[model samples]
Target chain A: MSRQPRASGYFRTSYQADRALVATRLERAMLVLFVVLLLAFPLFASAFLLDLACQVFLASIGALSLMLLTGYAGQISLGHAGLLAAGAYSVGILFREVNAPFWITLPVAALVGALLGLMFGLPSLRLRGLYLAVSTLALHFVVVHAGAEYETRRGYSTGVIIDPPQIAGLAISDPRAWYVILLAAAAGTLLLCLNLLRSRTGRAFGAINTHETVAAALGIDVARGKLLAFVVSSSLTSLAGALFAYYRGFVSVEAFSLFLTIQYAAMIIIGGLGSLLGALLGAFFVTIFPYLIEWALAALPGAQRRASEFFAVNYAAFGAVMILFLVFEPAGLVGIWRRVQSYFLLWPFRHRPLTGARK
Target chain B: MADLELRRLCLRFGGLSVLEDVSFAVNAGELFALIGPNGAGKTSVLNCVSGLYHGEGAILFRDVEIGGYRPHAVARLGIARTFQHGELFAQMSVLDNLLTGRHARIRTNALAEMFGLPGVRREEARHREAVERIIEFVELERYRHAPVAGLAFGTQKIVGFARALALEPTLIMLDEPSAGLNRDEREDLARFILRIKHELGITMIWIEHDMQMVSDLADRIHVLDYGRTLAEGPAAAVLRDERVIAAYLGRAHARPAAGAAGGGAPGGR
Candidate 1:
């Protein structure tokens, strides 16, 4: 593999260097600093802000899985919320029925997700593009309806209440503890996704995503690759869902709606398709955006008068922002980040040479 | 035994027959050229052999029936192919593109890959070394890290060829390797194909449009006309066959001495 010489004078002398997740000492230091900041944030943050950070981490897990399926694998799904619901319901049912512990429920939720992923991925073998999306959408309704049926049958019309998960006699109810747990989960998910993307399986997904025919010709099992993407993504989504259940202390069909699915879709699309960092950034943006909008509305002159219409205004504003992103920045927030990075990276020069003849 | 053999291969799309009762055998370490006019089903033959199409016939590789196996299965049996349009993973880097060809060779499981286990990293390093050999062979070292989408068409074509070589396949199928290449690139391709046949001792089934290049490189020529075989024999004789000229070649073009010498190198096998 080849690379343009960096201004930092970092050169890889071995294949391992080329394959490293963090190639340079500066990057390694920056990653460590970033991790330190994330870990220390809970010590100083207020309860509200800490909760918001937890929400971002939860959304990030969901967004990253969605990005893996729809972004990298090119398998469209409108059933993300349904998959999330499946996870939540799995946790709720297992805990209520069998009094399953934290460790047991999470894996069960993931297994349930994998099974449902295979079922959802079946139609993908025979359909593509809009048709595949429609099938997933239909499956989403089925899943949500199943959850609703459980709620009604169990006579818990409101929702299934979940106790906070515990590990080694310590309850994860504290905001700071939840923060650490979710942070670790999110980081683990990120690492897992990164590992998958760098290997042979990931390459097969990318190949099939680009062109199934060519991928098949190149000896990639396109059908198996598609199924694998679904299974992995669904299991991850389900895990996030189970985490959401424990974190919120409830599971309700109302929580997993068509709009929730769209929000997840928007995260990947507005984050930039096929990028893990974009997924995280998109998650952060979408999670914090409501608060930003609310703060803006509160600062307005007629805020008290328009309080009842807040939800409607927020929905409309979200749509408008998504449209703006799709139109002006189709590459998502990651595109903006790259431009800023390049600006600093190429300081004193406005543009790269046409032929990439860096001297 | 022939490295690859097709017996009475037939392919149909609805009512239209794309290939009709075509059969050919490529011997071990021999470069067998499949040529014809447009829509002569030259590419189709490669497709059927590579398992992209399920043709009604017997396709044996090293005496093993491989007709109905999936593409990946056939590739696991040590067959590799390049498409007419390169068909490289457009968004992936050239290194990744080549690495995908190593898919069938990858021994690590999904769990290992997801965990980035030490074994996976070591396996990846080993495969990268193999892929690097291919890049060196094709002289694509400069473009190794660049994304395939940004490369010139000629370079992408070569990358496609290099990817097939990375498979370390016993039989490599090249579909129109010289189709869109400029003269220099074509020469480079011809040289590479020759080296593959002579140095690596790999058998090849090459679908070509350039008669000069085909005559120069192919040890045996198989000509098709409207989905049927018109001539199948030694390159010089087949090129001179009257029916072959009438159906495809149309006229007698002088065979250059350089090509004849290059073509002669494979006969020793």
Candidate 2:
């Protein structure tokens, strides 16, 4: 979460100290407070707020998956929502066909996602950057078409209706239960991503992204790293989609559109590419933004007249904000957050000399 | 026994030939030097051996054919290489970048590693200890945690050498390891190379246009001029050869850039 690689007075004498995620007492306290707040949230929050929290949790998982692949591995993908759809549709198809339980549906979703990841990753072996992005984009269309065809063939004209997933003979559709489950899922994913990044697997991703020739020369299997990244990221994303399907009790091809894919991409870019905190922050911002816009518009005098084109206004606003972030704050919110923290941390001392700059 | 052998190698781009029938053999525990003028395809020879380039020839290590293998597969057979332009992961810390050199040796399964399981964690500690020793050897402790991208060019080159050393390579190919280093750093590098050869018994292929470093450290010199072997023998014999003096030494003194390739230029890349 700290942007500075080395913070003031953070001397690490051992490897354990160097790798510790929470070093200072302040960080530990902050983490405790954060967890306490999260647990207590559902106790006092409104139903709508609880649902929003669930949505943010779901989006966090997908955003984290995208961050792992694109931010860390440096593999650009535009088929994220397609993978999500695959997961959701797998649950739908499996449940409708064999009366599959939630347990069966979730793993099936992950498996389908892994296979699709393999298919998508094959093209990355021969392409990079924009070309690879385009390849993923094309695959997204194919996946959406498959899901649409399934819906039409199954005679579900509107969309598939997913039953509330049950665990231990109890339904999980209660807002409180859903909130806790989603929170646990999001927390587990964050932990998983943190560990992977600190391991050799994550370093290989960074190496491949920085320089493919160098990565290969250093004995990293470039193709394997790329494919493994896709597999792991897609698996996590599909799992998130399965959770989404269960949360909403619905699965619709129309829901998983190109705009949805763009929104997920926006999450990573707006969050901060390499930082997990950025993904969570970006998810929070994107998920709550439309509501905020609607509220603000309602407060305006011409709200009734503007209601006709609210969707259009939302689309234009999102695009404009994305562009502004890209041009003015390339590092996203994390970068800006760090700069502000540094300013306060180093008050009365404006500039650090080159020798002192590292810490 | 020969540690590595490149036999009748040929590489080209379209109609332009980059390496023409280039053949060389490095012996066990020997520091072999490859010297040539710019665009003489010296780096190409290393590239072909490291599996970065596809050439028409056979490359053998320990009597096993490795010509067409991928770079990682070849590296798994205990060969390591450094780049001329410092092809390092710039955003990563020096320690992280060096640990990457040991990627081939890490055999933990993905599942085990994902959870930071006991086996991989212990393995990581061992590798980290080795990397720390390298950081000490190169005197880069101050920059160990700093990103390689922000380090000075000379320090980055030192990090590059330390990274290759981290591989514990049996056969190390150093492509201009001391390119941008200062006098003190170059001297330290020379000492490191000497210790690596005499103490560790690692075979090395040292490429450089700096004749002094090459002649001082190399057991043998293989000279190239315009993608052709100009001379090959003991350092003293090759240094004295008329053709070597005329083709390489004479031009290097006239124009230094003529000896160092303009990295990633429109040449054989």
Candidate 3:
């Protein structure tokens, strides 16, 4: 249950009230407004903006999953891109070989992701910190190599082409449809994460994250928690990857690179370490950042002459932004958002009194 | 059968023997104090019983041999412990920290919890009620919502104790629960200890350095010096034992000053 006192008029007298996601009338109104805006965005947005929103939604799924594994459960996994690739390939291989339907492929992709997650999580039992990260990195390389091998052996040199997923004879190729589908997936993932975090399983993850021995003494199976974190996070991540494959109509090892893993890691870090909201914000910022850079570069003087150098510039700029966030805003955008919220909440008084009734 | 028993527990860290053939038994609903000087393997015994250390001996809780079991396995058999350093989930609030103690009790699976099904919700509500009662018993209502890292040290220790109590275990192991508390807090802890024994009737194996509190609260006291049992008896008799006195106050104070050697007493080593 949330312990923070609300605005002066609201009071939570019961545990259910305290645990309710939306407590006040103002919050409920804001939520309604937010949902309305999200639903209406596709009707007014251009094709490019719709695609960008879809990408953000897709990235949010991966970022939230990563946040659950690395942020809450305290398991370091650099094999996220590998899990994604496994999901995409499961879809790619199943479709290319058997011409499977979307319904069959998605669950199969999740199962593949779960198996890979189990393999990736095994090292975590014997290792921690940097060593564990290295093991995951090695696994990522192995998965990517296998994907490359499949491409060569199958004679699909460039990549695997996945047909658009069809639901009830309707092809999900339109940007608006993709946007709505991805939005639902992202929202579902967020709700699932919230549910897990508020339950016994989530508390066990938090306790294991804080102290493994203490978690064990409290009757939490630390190894099982770690594996479950990996399996759950990996499955969600794979689902995102599968959606990404369907959205892009391609499954290629080139797209699931180490850089992609780093980008997802950056999303969690620049968003905020442990917060799910931070994951969403980070996904939006990271996905649209390159486009934002391109727009800014286009408006500068002599833009056409330096257009060829834009990729290098993007890389440099991205690194600089990540470093800045790490150095100056360690808590990420959520930290900044909280500061602003508290500033407005306590406008007249700079700080809450040290010895008052529930500051 | 004893609530907890350690048969010839021997623990060695590389070449250093921390606990050597230390045997003890704690009766049901008894407050058993394990006292020792620094590095006397007092904490090690708790670690062994809690399954943190793989000591060579039989650790039986309610006649079930749990010597080689993992910590979670040991806990599944109704054993819980509090660390000396307050190893609480620092980022979580006090209520959440205590709720983790209800992990074993909450039987809902991850899938059920993920969807937040009706059964899961009901189970959670039931556990929350029990945890609230524990918070009230520990007088931690004021700090219930506060993050554990932000609380004062003594309060954090209290939260750790409360977390252990939330397990509703048959046996609770406390490792220096009163180490850093002030006199007033220590007194309150001693009172709580007596209440936990008398009112709750839970068995305890407390490792503490505070002689006065231990003497007042402990039904039986087991003294350890250099990985060996120095004395074991009722609290009053154990405190008056010559060996226990020497272990605490040194050989010079244990005997007449004139007869004691000036240097290289066995207690000095």
Number of the top DockQ candidate: 3
Show where candidate 3 strays beyond 4 Å.
A1-5, A352-359, B250-269
Off by over 4 Å in 1: A1-8, A353-359, B252-269
User: Which pairs in model 3 have colliding backbones?
Assistant: none
| DockQ per model, Cα | 0.47, 0.52, 0.52
DockQ category of candidate 3? medium
lDDT of 1 by residue, A1-359 (tens): 22333554666788877888878778789999999999999999999999999999999999999999999999999989999999999999999899999899999999999999999999999999999999999768988999999989999899999999888888778999999999999999999998998998888888889899878877788889999999999999999999999999999999999999999999998999988988999999999998999889989999999988888889999999999999999999988877777667778897853323211
lDDT for position B247 in model 2: 73
- Give iRMSD, candidate 3: 3.1
For candidate 1, write residues B44-106 as lDDT tens digits.
888888888998989999899999899888888889999888888877778998999888888
Off by over 4 Å in 2: A1-8, A11-13, A352-359, B251-269
Give residue A101's lDDT in candidate 1 (0 to 100).
Answer: 96
Which tens-of-lDDT digit does each residue in A129-189 have in candidate 2?
9999999997689888998999899998788898998788887778999999999999999
Clashing pairs in 2: none
> For each candidate, C-alpha RMSD in Å?
4.2, 3.4, 3.6
Mind giving the per-residue lDDT tens digits that candidate 2 earns over B198-232? Answer: 88899999898667788888999999888888999
